[model samples]
Target: MKDAAKASGSKEQTADTTGDEGEAPAAKPKKRKDNKGKDAPHYSVKEPAGYYPILPVQVVPAAERPRVFAYASSTRRDFEVFNRYDLSQDLDFLILEIRQGSHSPFLLVLMYNQDAPDDTQQRGRSFERFKALALPDMPIVIAMDANEHHPLWEREKL
Candidate 1:
């Protein structure tokens, strides 16, 4: 709401701020104390329903080339293409290196590999590329969305 109020380029009026029917009117228009005693802010509604601001998305590369990108509210996230580790370059991979406070930075990898038939060479490229990486000793979060149900990961029956 604060972001919206700032975007609208106007102070939050009483009609825009208060939803309570019994709320008292302020002495001056567009001057209302918020919950924290700060000046209230709001965005004008365009229609009868209300104003619905488009949620911001932060793409890592900020380009059309990157088919895989991270979406988050804040654009301060640490992430990159991270294609160096992917020797084969046959996977849709995006990696995020996050460091919180004094904790060690970790890797957040997102991989999307297409499902290939069993015993075929098409599916092994991504796996081989991942195994070839010389990763550091830190927590790694790998999110893979694939249709592979191999027994190697303890999946005997699919």
Candidate 2:
């Protein structure tokens, strides 16, 4: 049985090498045509003034793929740490709240961190310990610093 396994392994290796040798070179993907000139067909699309429509985003359902509700404290220390460690992986949405007004909820985005490295391999690890804790899929709101940094205005010589 051991001899047969070794023979099969050798045959598989030889077959893989032969397959590689017989395979054609990969072709480059086709690029889309630039529609910058007047010859390009223009669809009749009108934009409403003062009221912009929210664009639809591709998001996997929570049932199929677990969704994360990530938010930083008012100091944004956690966010900075997460960003530095490149830990925002497998997160369907990244909700960033600009302000915590008297009656304002949070703004969200159904996207992953574009800047993180090895994100594919580190899938769903972004949730970390939070994964164990059960949470609802409701809107997560995080109040942020309205003006964290401001230039001090002092009377000085120009």
Candidate 1 lDDT at 35 equals 60
Candidate 1 per-residue C-alpha lDDT over 1-158 given as tens digits, one digit per residue, 9 for 90 to 100:
22223344533222223423343422344565656896443322222232322211111111112224343333333432122222222325555555666677677776665543364454554445566767678788888775476566775553
The residue-level lDDT of candidate 1 at 36 comes to 82
Q: Report the poorest 10 consecutive residues by lDDT, candidate 1.
A: 55-64
The lDDT, on a scale of 0 to 1, for candidate 1 is 0.42
Candidate 1 ranges with C-alpha deviation above 4 Å = 1-67, 75-91, 115-123, 149-158
Give TM per candidate. 0.37, 0.23
Distance from true location, Cα of 16 in model 1, Å = 36
Error of 2 at 104 (Å): 6.0
Clashes in candidate 2: how many?
0
Q: What shift in Å separates residue 106 of candidate 1 from its native position after superposition?
A: 0.7
Best candidate, lDDT-wise?
1
**Per-prediction CA RMSD (Å):** 17.8, 22.0
